[model samples]
Structures are given as C-alpha cells and as structure tokens.
Target: PFRFSALTRSCVVIPCTFQYEEDIPLTRGIWSKKTGGIVFHNGQSNVIDHFKGRTKILGDLNEGNCSLEIDDIKPFDNGPFCFHAEKGHDKYRFNNSCVFIVMKSPEKPVMTPVPAEVDAGSTITVSCSVAHTCPSHPPVFSWSVPDLSSEISHTLTSPGIWETKSTITFMVAAGDGVRSLTCTAIFWRDKQQAGTVKLNVK
Candidate 1:
C-alpha cells in the first residue's frame, strides 16, 4: 500500500505496480473506488463523472505499470483506490493493491551537496529542489544572494514525485567567503519553507 498527499486544487500521482502469473501482453488498465465502482477506464464512458477527464493511467500498461494521476484535487477525491488489468485473455483485479491520497502541507526544500570550496571570481551554480504534488501552483524558490540571477524549473522526477528547482549561477567574490547560501520554497496559500548551506570562497 502506497499513499500520496496533494494540495487542494493541485495534482497527485499515485504510483502502482502489478504482477501476473503468465507472460501475456497487458491490454488494459482500470481504476476502481469504493467497492468495485470503476472510476477510470479507456475513454470517458463507464467512468464516474467526478473523475472523468481528470483521471488517467500515467504509467505504461504494457510495462505492468498502472500508476494513476488525478488532477485538480477536490475534497471528495480522497481515496483508497485500486488498480486492475487485462492481460491477453486473462483478467485480474488487484483488490489488495490500494493507494491512498491525502492533502499535504508545505515542507522545506533540499539542495544537492555543494562543494566546500569556491574560487573567487569563478562562476558557480547551485540547484535546490522540492517534491510537490501540485503542478499548477508549484513551489517557487528564492535565494538569499544579493542581486543574483537564478533559473526555476519543474519536472516529474519519478513516479508520484514532481520537483520544482531553482538554480543560481554567480561569480564568487572574496567578500562571499564563509557566507550562508539560503534557498526557500514558497508554496501555495502563503506556505513557505527554507534551507541553507555554508559556502566557502577561496
């Protein structure tokens, strides 16, 4: 059982893995909720209204990945959802494979390890990223560096994991020696978190 928490009005990706006894080709993927009620299938029909067009299998079915994505999270969308698959002539429903979705609160972003030494007059770029569910309102990154230029980007780094990163490249100065480099993640609804690391200029 796996779970993901998405922010309201955001999106959540629920990763799922499946197995079979035979080597037949996987032909279809299905998602059901609350006692076998199909919430998602190919096309629009047979899917519940609330989930129509908003839910789909993000993973490749042929690869035995039935991961699901639900966009624009609503309060009623909280679910302990399940996945099913059709492999050639054999069919199976993974009633035991359930993934839950929870609404999340903002958390601090983390930066990759930076080198301990930076040379004066040399340009360096530092990247910071955070996992978030909401792509529409991704967390924004801010730097404590004065008058520095930075680049911000978003990417789905893994199943159920979306990342927003901020990168800054700056010419190091002797005055920057032994200074703190801080990165902050500003999330939806005024939620914020930050992390800092020491930067040593040689």
Candidate 2:
C-alpha cells in the first residue's frame, strides 16, 4: 500500500514482503539509508547504532515482513531508501527490494543565530529550528559544536518526533582557527539531520 504525510517530522510505514519455498526458520531483512553518496547502516545483528535508540522495527522478522519504521525524520532524509530481505533455502534463496518517498512540510527549516560573527572571547548562540510540524507540538532546536570539543545543549518543545535545537558558547583564540564550528538540528520524527554550516568568528 502507498502512504503519504504532510507532517515533516513523522514516521511513515512502508509495507514489504519476502517469501521462500523452503522451511527456513530465520529470514533476515536489511535497511539502508543513502545520502551524499554514502550508505548509512540502519539495521544489522540485533539493533542499529545511533539509530538503535531512535529507530523502531514495525515489521515481523519471522513472517518475512521487511517494513521499516524511520524515526526523527528530516528533509534531508528524503530519498530512495532501499530495503532488502532474504530467505535462505537448501538450494536457492529469495530476495526483494523496495523504495519509499518521504515528503516534507512546506514550513521547512529556518536557522537563527545570536551573532553571525563572534569575537575571540565571547559567547555564541545558534538556534536550529523548523517553522511548524503540527499545532500542538512545536519544533525544537539542537546545537552541534565540534570545534569547542564540548557538550551541546538541546531544547525540546513537544513530541520527541517534532524538533530539537542545539546551542553552544565558545571562547575563541588563534589556536582555534584551524578548528571548525558547526550546529546541527535533527527532527526526531524522521532522523533527518540537515546540512551543517561553518561557524564564522571574527
């Protein structure tokens, strides 16, 4: 069955199937995310990494259902996710694949920063946000600061799926010039982390 959703930060179910003629006790299915010419491993062994805490498995493994539950969705996550499932048999094996299209809300995302450019010794504020996903729940912002080598601050407003923002403060100096600063906001609904921007300090 085909599914669609107006909500940007939401998980959509895609029904899939895999069958084998032999009596196989265990059938395995694989889920992979393709982004920027990189294939992110979604599921393997028992659980997924980074995605383990966020992703939910809706399909029945024994029944040969390979449907996936994508969480913390984002616009960047929109792509042709290839789902493959295989059933091993005595002589031959069976496999299947499918694609899903995740739609985003018109609201999209708008990032706001306290200062576009910061000085050597000061605090910097960067807000990662989305216009709207639903009325009851608002978007959250989460900041990602790799250069500072410090922890990030995340603010949540509603359902874990809505949005998250990260904020950080840094005291810059000549030594920090080689380092890079970045802020990332991940919509919990689809596990979509947006493109990172370089922090500018004066």
Candidate 3:
C-alpha cells in the first residue's frame, strides 16, 4: 500500500513497482479506482474523462516502472487507486497494491519578529506560524539556525484547523549584522512548505 499527500491544485506522483515470476513481453498498464473505474490507460482510448488530461505515466513501462503523475489535483481525487498490468495473453490486477491520495490546502508559513529592530546584546523573539486543518498530523517545524533556542506551540484556530507557532529567542551580537531565519513546516507524507524573515540589528 502507498499513500500520497498533496496540496489542492498541485501535482502529485504516485510511485509504483511490480514484479512477476517470469519475464513476459509487456503489453499495457492501467490505473483504476476502487470502484473499478479506469483513471488511466496506456492506450488512452478508454481513459475516463475526469482524468484524461490530468494524468500521465511518469516512468517507462519497458523498465517495469508504472509510476503515475496527476496534475491539478482536486479534493474529489482523493481515494484509493490500483494498478493493472497486461502481458501477452496474461493479465494481472494488483488489487492489493493500492495508493491513497489525500488532498489538503497549501498554507504558507508566516514569520513575525518581536521588536522588528534589535540593538546589540538585546534579545529578540521571532515567531513562525502556519495554519492547517489536519490536527491529527500536525506539521513539524524547523529553523535554519543551528543550536538556536526555540519553543513550539499549537492552537485550535477554527473547526478542524490548527495554528502552529515556533518561536526562536536569540540575543543580537555585533557580528550578527543582518541575518535571515527560515522556518520549514513539514506535513504528513513529506509535504514541506517554508517561509523566511530577515532580522535587522541596529
């Protein structure tokens, strides 16, 4: 089983691999939904209209790669899909080998600096935040600064939505003229989004 998470209106790649007992001449490949509705077909003649121009095979079939790419993903695209392969007079359906796609909204992180301008030897706090609906799979936060002291917290902003905030505290030094702090938010399935803020030391 495979799982993929992607932002709405974005593209996602569903990786697939298969092996057979004996080497046989490859014929075609097909991806279908749980209801046996064809999402994609190698011949392109029987492809469902909903996925006609939005889906494509990413890997070469001759090399036994049947990965698929879906563009402009929508909420309706979420669900389980399986792959089917065909060889000379032999057909194989991988009902067990399925992929589930989850769709989410893309939220860019926001960086806010307390005391926008800091003096040398003074401490300042920079906060990076993002709002997401998946509380069960909260986003992981990371700062670009190594060995930086930080604190993380989360709040329930609205129904099914959560706001995560990471604050980094640091004292400005003469050597730290102008520095940039980058915050990366990683969601489930390795979906990563980031934002940055530049600190001005006066």
Candidate 4:
C-alpha cells in the first residue's frame, strides 16, 4: 500500500511498476479508483469524463512502468486507487497494490533571520519554514535570490505533520543595507505561498 498527500486543486503522481515473464509483451496500462472507475487508460474511450484530460500515464508500458499522474486534483479525489495492466494475451490486476491519496489546503510560510541586524562584511543566515500535514508530500522551498546557496531540512512536528526549513547564507556588504530576502513554498497541486524578511546591515 502506498500513501500520498496532495493539496486540493493541485496534482499528484502515483508510482507504479510491474514485472512478468520476460517473453510476455506489455500492451497497455490502466489506473482506476477502488470502485473500478477508470481514471486513465491507454485507450481514450474507456476513461471516465472527470479524469479524461486530468490523468496521464507517466511511465513506459513496455518497460513495466505503470505510474499515473492526476492533475487539477479535487477534494473528492481523495481515496484508494489501483492499477491494471495487460501483458500479451493475459491481463493482471494487483488488488493489493494500491495508493491512498489525502488532500489538504496549503498554508503560508514563516521566515526568520538570526540577529535581524548584521554588520557590513559579516555573514548571516536566514531560515524559512512551513508546516504541512503530509510528510509523503512535503512542501518544497526556494529562495528568490538568484544563485543563492541554500540548505533544506525537514522535521516531523507531529503525527502525519512535518515542518520543512530552508536556510540560506550570504555575506552582507555596507551598500546592501535594508535588503529583503524572500522564500517561496510550493505544495501539492502547485499551490505556492511566500514569506519575506527585511535585513538591516549596519
């Protein structure tokens, strides 16, 4: 069983793989809900309307990859899903191989810089963090400063929740007084929120 978390109105990828006798040729792949509703199929005619243009197969069938991607995810999309495949003249369905999707709303990020003030020619570190409920789908952090060196880490804040932090270090110059550092957090479904901190360089 695979568990995944995503933000509503975002996208999610379900990882899948299959193996069979070397002589068997893989024909097609399918992704469906627990109720047997087709989310995606190699043939267009069989796919459900709600998932027609929103779903895609991310892997090559011939190589035994059956991964699926769901776009514009909705709250109702939360649930268990399964994969099916066709190999030569035989069809295979692994009921036990399933994924459970959990969706949540996104939150704004928090930014912190130690000392808040720094001396010219001094080095400083700024940290940006955010809390998210899905460790399986942790939020991604990025800095607005171009070519900036940054490090990222995550901690389990609680059951099923995680806190991710991104720290960036830079040297301050006398002329670079009153500068602002921006941090952007990207969550599932591509939803993004950002935070900024102002620095006073003496």
Error in Å for residue 178 of model 1: 14
Question: lDDT by residue for model 1 over 1-202, one digit each (tens)?
Answer: 5767777666676878776656666778888885657777885798988888888787777676777778767876777787878756666877457777878766678887778888777777888998887665688777887536788888998667788988888777666559788888887555688999988887
- Model 3 over residues 43-120: C-alpha lDDT tens digits? 676888888887777777667678787766778887688887888767787545687887766788999855667687
TM-score of model 1 (CA atoms): 0.66
Each candidate structure's TM-score, on Cα atoms with residue i matched to residue i, is 0.66, 0.38, 0.57, 0.66
Task: Tell me the deviation in Å of residue 199 in model 4.
Answer: 4.1
Give me the runs in candidate 3 sitting further than 4 Å from their true place: 107-194
Better of 1 and 2 by TM-score: 1
- On TM-score, the candidate that comes out on top is 4
Q: Pick the candidate with the highest lDDT.
A: 1
lDDT of 2 at 130: 53
- Candidate 3, after superposition: displacement of residue 77 in Å? 0.3
Give all candidates' CA lDDT scores: 0.77, 0.47, 0.74, 0.76
lDDT measured at residue 81 in model 2 versus the true structure, 0 to 100: 56
**Could you arrange the candidates by TM-score from highest to lowest?**
4, 1, 3, 2
lDDT score for candidate 3 against the true structure: 0.74
| Tens digit of per-residue lDDT, candidate 2, span 136-159 | 333344444433533333343432
Worst 10 residues of 4 by lDDT: 131-140
> Taking the tens digit of each residue's C-alpha lDDT, what string does model 4 give over 88-162?
667788655688887766778998746767787777777889987544457888776643477889897653357
